[model samples]
Target: MYQADIAIVGAGMVGLALARSLKEADLSVILIDTTPIAKPLSEQPELRVSAFNAANKQVLEQLGVWQHLDQQRLSAYTQMQVWDQDSFGRIQFSSEEMGTSELGHIIENQSLVNALHHQVSQQPNVQMLPSTRIAKVLAGQSETMLMLDSDEVVSCRLLVGADGANSAIRKYANFPLTFKDYGHTAIVATIKTAAPHGKVARQVFTPTGPLALLPLSDPNLCSIVWSQNSQQADELLALSNSDFAKALQVAIEGDVGEIGVESARMHFPLTMRYARQWLSDGLVIIGDAAHTIHPLAGQGANLGLQDAFALADSLQKLAAEQAAFHQARQLRAFERARKSEAVKMIAAMESFKQLFGGSHPLKKLIRGVGMCTADAIPVIKQRFITQAMGW
Candidate 1:
């Protein structure tokens, strides 16, 4: 049997960050994950990437892992351009307006995971168990026990589920989930553009869905995320590399000039999910394990990171007062704070997805005009930028 103050299931960015945060507070932590730590990053960029906003950067900085990231793989975008393909209305947001050097950074997912893993290795108070699967979870009054596939039992004062959307801990703990399928698939790929990305992120709303060209570290390279209906996604996936590139060029209105596919395309279905309750006695959930929102806003990862920071902050504060490690009252407070914020963001993203995805003429006109109007209003635009910065 293994025991710790807290046992975190899932060693992804959120889980790792929480472990590092807790350990920094002199708490014992056990970090478990089914996937082995990824090998060191190579010159080639990984296909999976995420946009880290100001808040996320702050969390990483606090964890002392931000400096360890490969500088070559980090791309900071200072501007964002969003427009509707059906109308002439467009909106542009710049960091200059907000007195910030950059809005956010685009980084490969593997790079982040690697950095977190490296930091965890340096934390003597944190024990990492990789390639270990949790078979079952038993929640008790004073502690929770996780049964591993290897027939080992790990007990902890508190158990946190940072696992992805389909979280096993959430299931075993009986956290009810509300799920809604977006009926769309997001296709992701890396591409080389004829023109440099100019440190900007571009998103265009097509009749089918939204297509985003996120700036990459390489000025001439960009990461594309195209969300479309099932039929369109399948068709795009079936197209040859050159054909797909051509289609992509037409889709983005060739804003960055011609593009050539630089990597194999991959995709996954889109869904919005939320856990009805985020805490149960000594058990709690964070990150995708608690809620998942549409990728249209690209706030999913940021939200998860915020949850980790919030939870860690709460736990540290409580520990200072000599509170129980898994006091239900404190855990509930953390849940309330994070769940409310997550729900608000998820609702806003859902609204955006529905408004821009509609086919009605009035809605299309409203979408375009609303964007233009928001752009014309400095206060509104600044508010949008501030929100995106995770303020």
Candidate 2:
């Protein structure tokens, strides 16, 4: 039999961050995952990337993992340009306006995970069980037991489901989940543009959906996330590389000049998931396991990381006060704090989707005027910039 103070299912960035944050706390942690904990990054940039805002960077720094990340693979974007195709409304945000050197860093997801894994490995209070699957979860009044595929039983005072969107832990616990399908697909690929990205992230709202070109480490290379209706996405995916490049050029109005696809294209359906209840007795859920939002704002990973920090803080307080680890009040407190933020972000993304995806003339006029007006007002733009930075 194996045991710990807390058992976290999933060794992704959020799970690992949680473990690392509690390294100094007087609690034992066992992290279980079905896959290997770490892998070498490819020489070429990865297709799965995330925009890490200032707040997320601070969390990484606090967890002692940010310093180990490969600087060559990180791209710092100092400016953002958002515009609408149907209207003359446009807004540009710069770090200079916010008195910061850079707004955020564009990092490959795998790189961040690798860094967190390395840091967790060095922690004395954490145990990582790789290639281990939980066959069953048995929740008790004060503890939860996980039956692994190897027939080993592990028990803990608290159980956390940090797994991805399709969370087995949440399912086994019978937590209520609400899902919203956006009826769109997000196509992602890396591209080489005729003009350099100049460390700027550009996004355009088309009738179909939003297309974002985020600057990568390479000056002439950018990662594109094109979200469109299922039918349009299928058509885009069916086009030849050259044809797709041409279509992309027209989509962004050639903002980065002529473009050519430099990597394999991948697409996934867009969905938002939320758990009605995030905590039950000795159990809790975080990251995509609890909620997931659209990719339009590139805030999914950022939100997940914040969940890690919030959960860790709650757990540490419980440990410090020498309170019962599995107390429902403490767990519910964490859930309440994080769930409210998740709800706000999810709603904001939905509003943006509807505002930009609508074909109504009034919405188009409002969007155009809103963008221009927001840009004109320093206080309004500052508020937006601060919010985007995860303030």
TM-scores, one per candidate: 0.97, 0.98
In model 2, which residue pairs have backbone atoms overlapping below 3 Å? none
The local distance difference test score of each candidate is: 0.89, 0.92
lDDT of model 1 at position 376: 98
Best by TM-score: 2
Q: Where in model 2 is the C-alpha error above 4 Å?
A: none
Per-candidate clashes, comma-separated: 0, 0
Name the best candidate (by lDDT): 2
Task: List residue ranges in candidate 1 displaced over 4 A.
Answer: none
lDDT string for model 1 (1-391, tens) is 9999899999998998898777657578999999896567666667788888998898789778899898888999999999998687799999999898999999998898888888888888888899999887777789888899999999999998999899988888788899998889999999999999999999999889999999999999999899998889999999999999999989899899989999989999998899999887788899999998878878888999889989999999888878885977777878888999989988898888888885788988888789999999999998999999988
For model 1, how big is the CA root-mean-square deviation?
1.2
